[model samples]
Target: MTDTGMTAPEPTAIDETRQRELQILSEDAVLKGHPHGDEQCKNCLYYLDVDEAISYCWHPKLRVLVGQDWYCQWWEEITAEA
Candidate 1:
């Protein structure tokens, strides 16, 4: 995976707009900052691993398809189901 090093969008002065932008931007930062290693989207709780190479991150703010090798700060170990 490639690291884009691109920063999040700057916050505007509007309170509501800034707050929402900050939230999304922070989450984006977390996703980009995650270390590239054994920790990957496939094993994360938020990932819906439907195939080997690609999967969906079900996070509310960051719903998107991620690769097996891609990871983020939001990653959590898969839990056992009852």
Candidate 2:
């Protein structure tokens, strides 16, 4: 994890063949930061909102407390159950 204004850490190496599989899983959860548009982390399946502003996401690579409205490329809409 890194502090604000710091460059993100180098990405973990993954098998190219499993890229799609990994993406699907990563998108299923959400991360913290400024939201990518209206894709708030609070609406994500992996978001654990601690309050109105503070929240945590079950990210595959990063696990840090963040604002509820934060988002990343791995953002995915929360699916509803039938």
Candidate 3:
């Protein structure tokens, strides 16, 4: 997979409006901004960078912009074939 130098989003960088529009999960709900063991958005199968500090979660249930370090219950490890 292509690397886009993804990083965590700044606190003010998150688009609250867009987040609400998409009904993105709350940080608490998704366990975001915290790593689950070695799992994170940057290493998940659904993550796609939108910019250096922002990415899109392509998971059907998410489909929201996320930070590289964000983690969710749906987090899936990216395989070599992905």
Which wins on TM-score, candidate 1 or candidate 3? 3
Q: Which stretches of candidate 3 lie over 4 Å from their true place?
A: 1-24, 27-29
TM-score of each predicted structure versus truth: 0.54, 0.49, 0.61
Q: Which has the greatest TM-score? A: 3
**Whole-model alpha-carbon lDDT for candidate 3:** 0.75
Residue 75 CA displacement from its true place in model 1, Å: 0.3
Candidate 3 per-residue C-alpha lDDT over 9-80 given as tens digits, one digit per residue, 9 for 90 to 100? 665535767666455456434656777889888888988873546688888877777888878899887889
RMSD in Å for all candidates: 10.0, 10.3, 12.4
The worst-scoring run of ten residues by lDDT in candidate 1 lies at: 29-38
Q: Write the per-residue lDDT of candidate 1 for residues 44-72, one digit (tens) a residue.
A: 78878646677777877677667777777
Candidate 1 clashes between residue pairs 3 or more apart in a chain or in different chains:
none
Which residue segments of model 2 deviate by more than 4 Å? Answer: 1-32
Total backbone collisions for each predicted model: 0, 1, 0
